[model samples]
Target chain A: MGGDFPRGKSAIAGLATFGVGEAPGFSSMELTARAALLAVEDAGLRIDAIDALFICQPDDFFAGLSFAEYLGLSPRFTDNNRTGGSAFMSHIITAVMMLEAGYIDTALIAYGSNQRTNGGKLATSIKPNSWDAPYRPLFPLSSYALAAARHMHEYGTTREQLAEVAVAARQWANTNPEAFAKGPLSIEECLASRIISSPISVRDCCLVTDGAAAIVLTRTDRARDLPRPVVPVLGAAAATWWNSIAQASDVTTTAAAESGPRAYHAAGIGPADVQTVQLYDAFTINTVLFLEDLGFCPKGEGGRFVSGGTIAPGGTLPVNTNGGGMSYCHPGMYGLFAIVEAARQIRGEAANQLGKIDVALAHGNGGTLSSQATVILGSADTL
Target chain B: MDGMTGGPEAQWRAALADGRFLLQRAISSGTVFFPPRVMEPGTGETDLEWVEATGLGHIYSLTWVSQKPPVPPYNVAIVRLDEGAQLMSRIEGANPETLRIGQRVRAKIGTQDDGAPILLFEPTGH
Candidate 1:
């Protein structure tokens, strides 16, 4: 993979978003088209300049081809590889490979959903024959709560540690006007919140808002020509261990165990070099798992590492600087938001900008801790 | 084993109706899998057979769906079956939050909303 791009690898040229909250009357296709156009505009390119496209959606009705048709794009390459929340991060790696191979010049990856305003449920309508239907597993959250319970049993992870994740995210969210969580959150309030699942309170879960995001990727040289500061795609990797929680070989450890190290190695750096981390926080346990599996701390010590406001606004490691899914906007699949936030950090344009930041790492978790994708991004100075 | 025609799913479902839990084991590799499948996961061997499990296991993990549910505040659990297979089932007659990991559980035949046979678990102590 290193030899494939000895010099001038792919870089993120533009990033754009739409409707962090309540885009009433906009269908998923409409949201997708608007996001794609905004990304191309941000890239300082015409909509027709895009030669490749990718779209992620919660439903199959709004397919990638339909989005292309709606956007009037006849791109040479297209993909709808939906890996839940990890889809967009996975797309960055796929786009990199295609850009290096000259299969496509400008790749546009976008996602949009009205899951909130549309009143959509995640898996209530899963195929009637699913093994999970009878037991009534509450979509993804229950499965994650179960994993959190196991982690607590094995590592003595306390409920307060989980509440801290929500508190830190709220602190970051309070800084961003676009964040859904409007006020400061206290650990006491987080612990007192209603429990959606045992061991996972409402605060521990992400916001169910409507939103969309997009990114433009091209070769490094091509990115230099774009309007915004070029953020090089230092590294990107993806892994999937299982689709269902019941079948997961090990629930405590996720695919991040594989993708995290691979992404770091591809970037020729390690976790310590990352100034800020944009990790998936669909649930508090997700942050806990990624921190440990990504080697930020010794395995099972994530509870200790995250205590004492370690990941809060002024903490040593600023994670989910844009309030993350917990406090920010989690329209649905949150993978793209991590990349969007990482790019913002690299470009020094984040709403809650951190000091002395050069390298940012974005990690995504999909399904019931089933799929994982890690992306490493750096400022032009690092490039 | 060579003539195993119909997939193991139907057989397993049928066993649930008869108050027995069925698991599939790879005849060659001796690997056990729940929610039975046709071929072994890694080896892709079709030499699979249905075996009656001890219908007993310990809770590996559990969660209470406090939200709207088929039953208010029901317990969902992943039980490590005695046959070395793990599957998700509902536990009856136990406090959701009070349920402890590693507590012993036993399989019991149950019916879903449509009266379709399914596997569930309950605390052996209860």
Candidate 2:
């Protein structure tokens, strides 16, 4: 074992294109379609070459759309899956399975939500249609606020450390032209934003935007003929939690804590070998929690490690080169953006290119921090 | 499939109301269920009954939302009642400002004007 994790495929070639649809640019659907078109163009192929399509599921209230008919996609094998924010990266794992099984030739995965349309006001929080009742959406900010509180109580991590994460994200956003929360964000500002849940302010939450992003994947053979360099899937994994918050073994650790190691082993690489990373940032705490859970640093050291400027621009690993969901465009399934950005940087095409990245890590999660998917990408076509 | 009472909106309101909540289901093949139904979720068993619980449970998990939750930062938690039934409820007694997990919480009963007896949980100060 090179480090600790598993080694992935030697060569599984394919071109995965990502399109961010947000802000002064376009609506969720409009942006999704545009990205699909552009990805096809980037692959030097026609849209018809896309035999399969998977969409990041959006709540009916967010995008005002439901499943079935794939909304505008006419793919021979089109389907939409709604797992959570991690649904985007989870699609990549599914795509790899389809490719290996030879289910279809080319596939495209798209995620779009008019977070701005709903203004992030997801309809009823209570279970709907089912025997479950209804209530205004009482989402993660509060849910996560609880978890963060427990973490602080158990580990004594300071709220200032959490504020640091928000501050860092806004800092990265400043460098990102398309970032929704870009520019300077003071600690006082983060501390001042209306508290959504205990310990979490409005600024602590991700930005809601009307946007859609897509990633196109083809067989290794077909990807070789594409215009831009193709990044291969070295390894992938996923996991889910038990019942509600009460059933979880640990509140601070997310499903990623379980999935990250599995993906690493499958890829035959350890956390230390990952040159760059794309940790899903639904909340700043998630970033720090996964940082430790993914083995980037020791547990509970997430606050200290990050406080030392480890995830910043000049740090050992530069995350969310695209500014991440916190600053970039969350749009619900912000995880997909993480996967796309990792691939871009590995391909040396990222706007915020870091050092020569040989391998990259992309971790995405869904549900109430319930589901997780971890993926590994490489700079070379074949390992 | 059990039907919603008053409506989805009302049921949730009832669920959140004090002493106005009660969920019961017969035990078969093990496991407590809310809203007694004739058919199981996966088995479709036509053997189900509704039974009133003792309405006493331990706080399984607790979270202290800073301000009111986006919806209302009140106490939201899963209480595993003594009767082996777990339900979501808003808690009181402890400050919403300093609630802790694994604390002893007792269910308090009250009635809504609509005559529905609401159930709420509060810290036993233990």
Candidate 3:
């Protein structure tokens, strides 16, 4: 089981976010810079301490080098990897590798988007005008909905089961202060929401938010010396089987099927060791799919597993403690937030804190469930 | 509009314009691919033939689009073609909500906003 596994001695030292929603006229670049500076401050480190930088090219707007120049910081290692929303988690894995290999000491990963303020609906034509354009899929939502419909067809998954996800996310959001949604939601109300696409209601989709998040990662020795609590990396992995949803072998499953087990195996822990989960819930269907694929439940059983509030506040498993994308801020990609929330949970700092979290798993889903990345974090005691 | 003008994309488009659905079949592996590729993904073989698809398949998956359709609600679907390739298209002239997975469908040629020939599917029984 030990073939080129990372030692996972790197830890998240600092985390920060800004411009949660509707940031007036703030550009993505500006919001990103603000968050980067805040992250450095949270780590109690000077701007010069960062030697590596990783940033996402959200919606083809910015690159790592351009952002590095804009931020007026020169770095030795840089990556502008855009694997959809999951890019941040992938960056964390990269940073850990670099840290282990003596390539860099401190790595800062950041993401920012103005999806709401720019009036850019993700449903707009985002793909190249191929032969498939005539089909009018409306991008990701329809792509995801198509998969959801198939899930129903194959497993008899009901629409109410999907609504239960929205309800649970809102229930969690009620306790989070920085979250965009902080109200009560009912299963019946969720079902009554307008259908964006069949089998997917308006409530099923993530919030279109204008926000940014940043985190600082360093060697465990350095992280421990920093002012903030340390959330040590346990294991990380990523995989992608297809880019286009149509080409996926099984629409009901995702790359998480590969990434999840690999990360857990690398961490030397099973699903039973995970105390909390920060799964990317861009859609309710996503949570259901991950719950099954990530080994929380049997395949085709996610519909029943999520029903009856199994993942809600009082449930045995507390997922998406920060409300998740269904109610929390989605911006464009919810990947970074998953890691940020995971770190918060590992440090016992989450607003809606779950009791005695020792090990936390953050699963990031990108594209139409095309790409996936998983990162497991543990507290100092567990490490 | 003949075959020699463009690459795989154009070849498929030209074939579709001629009322034929085209897919790439690797000569060595017998692997068929949709959205027409120049090379086989598995063997990376350039020795591929533009085989005609029967335009017959069942719905592998489908979604009902309730927003911003040129018309009203429409179905965007992935049809697992009889040739063992899958393509993204829509069911033509059928109620999207009524469409079911595994429903048999046949390919139909359609024009895009730019007047490019594209492929769509409709229930075979309809």
Candidate 4:
């Protein structure tokens, strides 16, 4: 795979988010359409200018066709790949490829979900294996719990270390005005929270909120004329190892180990060059797992690396500067929001914006640490 | 029920009713996998054979799921069998909070709500 084909060739021209915290009276389609329209307008482009559409709607069957019909667009190319939350991150790579290959000039990647409003009933739940379903594990959650338990057992990662992830996210959330859970959070509070699954408390999980996010992508040359600062797609890659945690070769590690290196290689940069990171933190353990897998620290050293406000505000390496899904908002699929925050950090428009981020990394995780996708975005100066 | 069926899952379920644990092994790669499939994973080779499991394994990973009032919490675990095949099951005859990873376990058949036999594990007490 020529991973560098789209490096610095494609750029995100516009980004928009709607109904992030709560969209009580809106449908998922409505949320998606509104965000799509806003994203087009943000780029100073009309609705009809979007020649390519990439959408992943968990609640809708044939999501691409349905979204096209709802938004009244006849795109020349479309993709509705559903790799869980990471689908949008993977879409960024696809959009870049389409733009570079001359298949489409403008790509609109979008996602929306009303899981919170629907009482947390996800229309598409990750189906456990037949042998595992009989035991009635609380899917997705239990899978992560198992990984956390194994991580603790094999590497001596303490619960306090795990709780630090939540504390850090909450600290960042306090500064983000659009964050849903701006209230103070402490490692003590996290440790004392009721256990939803062993080794993972209710506090360890992400907030369920109704939200939608969309980003408009075009060639870097065309992006020069767009309204916002051009955040070019420097590199992108994705990988999947297993469908269920039981089948995973190593529960403690994720496919990010594969995707991260490939993405960094494609971008012609290493982890040290990344000023900030936005990882898909569906659970506290997720951040720990991704940090280690993405080469932020040595393997099995993530727990120690995140301790003592390292990833918190004023930390060494700013992570989840937008509060992340754990505090900001997680509407079923969160990859789009991760990309949105990465762009925000690069554009110096994040609620908790860092200082002059030249390069940012946005990584997405899907299923039970199953699918992993890494996207490296950089400002014009890097190119 | 007779242990006779055209599909792998049916055969496995019938064997469970008779209190026997079975796993599929790929003939080409000599690799064992769970949730009996028609073809081996990765290679997709249809040449597969059923073999008796050792009924002894260690807990590779585990989690205790807490429920609302009146519903007791249950343990969900992944057991790595001695034959090198791992599966998802529950540890019986022990408190979930007291269990630890790498603890030895022995397989036992348990019945589900509809009287369908399910494979479970209990502490080996070593």
Candidate 5:
């Protein structure tokens, strides 16, 4: 992988999210169209100006074509690349490549899901693995529980540490009005919650909600003409080692170990330079594993690193400022929200906005800790 | 032999029916993998051979499924076979609450509700 691939080549000019918690009487496509139109409007561009479309819906086949048709778009370039939750981050990489190559002028990445109102079963198009199907491990929760169990056994990570993640997320959520879970959360409550899977209480899991998010990407020069600050794509990279948890060589680690460094190298920045981070917190263990894999802390020290309000408000590191999927909203795929929140922080427009965020990191995880994608975005000064 | 049929999975099922557990080993790289694949992962070696597993390994990770009444809870575990391959199976003949990671276990072929042979595990040396 070239270190300079698509570095600072493109910027996100506009982003919008619709149906964050619940949007009754709205189909996934309708939600996507709503967000897409809002994003184009935010960029001060007409919907007809979107020359490229990137989308992935769990229920739709050839989602890009369906979304393009739904929005009355005949984009010259379209991508329906599906890596589960991390697909949106990967879309950013592809959009940057197309923009830098002059294949397309403006690109839109969109996603939507109605998993909550339509019942909380994962609306994934993927069939169960023949080997794993027989065991009936609860889809993704059990896979994450297995990793949590292994992490505890190997590193002696206490349950208190896991509870802290949910607590911190809820604390952040209390500040965001759009957060689905906006109540005071304590570590004791998280530890006492009903166990959905061993070591993973109901509190540790992300919300099941209806939502759609879209972001528009264009060349940095064109983005400069837009009203919003140029949140340049400083770096982007993705990696996938295994699709199943049983196949992972080490359950305690994720592919973020591979994607994180590559993205950082592309951006010419390290973890130290990041002012805030938005991690795909589908499960509390995800934050622990990703923090270690992304070089925020040493391996096996993630449990300790996140404890003691380290990632909470008024903490050393501000994480998931939009309340994360664990509390804010998780509509099947949560990666796009991470990017959306990162852009908000970079543009100084976040609801729980931090001060002077020059650089921010957004990490996305897909499948059962399978695919990992890292996107490092920065203000124009960083370029 | 129960008339071994279909692909690698079918062969694996036949072996389990005969009260034997088997895993695949790549002939070229000597890497072992589970769930019976046509080609070796990572190495893409098609020339693979089946070997009888030791049926002895430790629990790499374990989780107990808490079910409502009328359906009893069970344990789902990833066992690291001594052969270096890992597979998801349930631990039987032991209290579900007592199971923990890193505990040594032995495999046993148990019949499921459908009368199909399935792989199971029980704590060893107890």
Candidate 6:
């Protein structure tokens, strides 16, 4: 993300930031209300302005009703873009598309589920798809297993480097009370944290806590009359490979390789322009894989790029500043939060802000290791 | 758990003959969903209708997995079928030596013990 592109305050006239919301992990309804209220309050708009509704959680036990009826979202455009973890971003991407096509403005994107409070039964009972329901790969854990095995087999990546990503996120999480994976998780502790999948341990996986977050996207003309006068959708792109985990061409690469370029081009920037990055970390391998796929480093060198505190706080391109999904709370809501954090960082409001507020990248992964979506956010000055 | 060959066996074979292994869902206007979903993705309606894929496709990208992966190494790829649907499946029936980007492939039904079918792509020899 290099170059100070052209951007004006008018370009983001309708932008606003809904205060990030979390709820008492009782049920999906509570999380929904929690996020909706924050979004409503943050935008300084009434709950009724949301003309578009998108939800990633498409299961009954979580939402307590069919999506449309459950949320009471009476929007013209609706999407439960369940591309996977990035479903939230997919929802946001859909909103942006609708806005560009003049489909609708003032859309509300929300995601909330309880793996911790709900006894983790919703995920276990609900099968991902017809092909996978039978196999029932532990998903994030097993999918990371595929990448762990590939990285170890191919690039001579050690277990320690992968652990570093988790460790760094935890260290940063201590500053943010909402993060689930806080506390000092030394490499030794991580190495011993119950091998969920080979080369990756329990801590390497996202926590099962329940939380909800919502963002309000309005027409550029309407953002000026909001709580946050800035923070607009700068650029977004999505890419998908066939979703056969076992049949992927390269475990180390991802659809981000394709999506990242498109997003950068749309934003009129390059990888180097990003000051912060919020990579989806349902598993450490994804964070690691995307570091390369998004052009942070050359292919097959993600392990190296992440080593030696390059992505840690006070390091070059400090990533996952708000603890990411690994330490933040993976509850499948990390995509929205990651984008939220990137927006927050671009606005210079993160707990661990590093450099000048310019460009930030948020990448989300979905469907076994195949689908990917990337969005680039930048400041008006740098735009 | 391993795949067994039984009742899921017979029905799967017949479905393969009928070319029912091809999946269609609402997730996209692009390709078949390998793992079928009850809903047509983007549409909340449970309007998922199964349709037979064109079965004819070109090799968009490929790799020769040298050894067993989680199960063992095998050839895997993203095949762009004539319907413009991209599917990721094991590339069987052709030697790795002769694989090319534009290689024509035929959809093959892989049957398991329980009579369920798994679709795998194989290169159609010229």
Candidate maximizing DockQ: 4
Share of reference contacts kept by candidate 3: 0.94
lDDT of 6 by residue, A3-22 (tens): 22222212222222222223
Q: Which residue ranges in model 5 land beyond 4 Å of their true spot?
A: A1-4, A125-127, B1-6
The ten-residue window of minimal lDDT in model 3 chain A covers: A120-129
Which interface RMSD does candidate 2 score? Answer: 4.2
Q: What is the Cα-based lDDT of residue B78 in candidate 4? A: 92
Off by over 4 Å in 1: A1-8, A119-129, B1-5, B67-72
Model 3: per-residue Cα lDDT at residue A317: 83
Better of 1 and 5 by lDDT: 5
Model 2: per-residue Cα lDDT over A3-49, one tens digit each: 23223322223233333434444455655666667766777877767
lDDT of 2 by residue, B1-126 (tens): 166465434554555453344544445755555444445545776565444465667766555454443544556665667766555566765665466666777877755466755566787767
How much of the real interface does each model capture, measured as fnat? 0.85, 0.33, 0.94, 0.92, 0.75, 0.02
Q: After superposition, how far is residue A277 of candidate 5 from its true place, in Å?
A: 0.7
Chain A, candidate 4, TM-score of: 0.98
List TM-score per model, in order: 0.94, 0.80, 0.95, 0.97, 0.96, 0.73
CAPRI grade of model 4: high
Tens-digit lDDT track for model 3 on A262-369? 999888998889988899998999999998989999989999999998899999888998998877788888899899999988777888888668799999988778
lDDT ranking of the models: 4, 5, 3, 1, 6, 2
> What is the per-residue lDDT of model 5 for residues A1-383, given as tens digits with 9 covering 90 to 100?
35567788799999999999988788888898899989989998999999999998988978999988888889999999878899999999999999999999999999998888877767776754877777889988999999999999999897899988999998898999888888888899888999877888898999999999999999999999998788999999999998889878799989999999999999999999989999999999999999899999999999999999999998999999889999999999999999999999999989899988989999999989999999999999998
DockQ of each: 0.80, 0.28, 0.79, 0.85, 0.78, 0.07
Put down candidate 6 lDDT per residue, B76-106, tens digits, no spaces. Answer: 5556677655555667766645765568998
Name the regions of candidate 6 deviating beyond 4 angstroms. A1-25, A61-73, A122-136, B1-126
Q: What is the TM-score of chain B alone in each candidate?
A: 0.85, 0.59, 0.86, 0.88, 0.88, 0.61
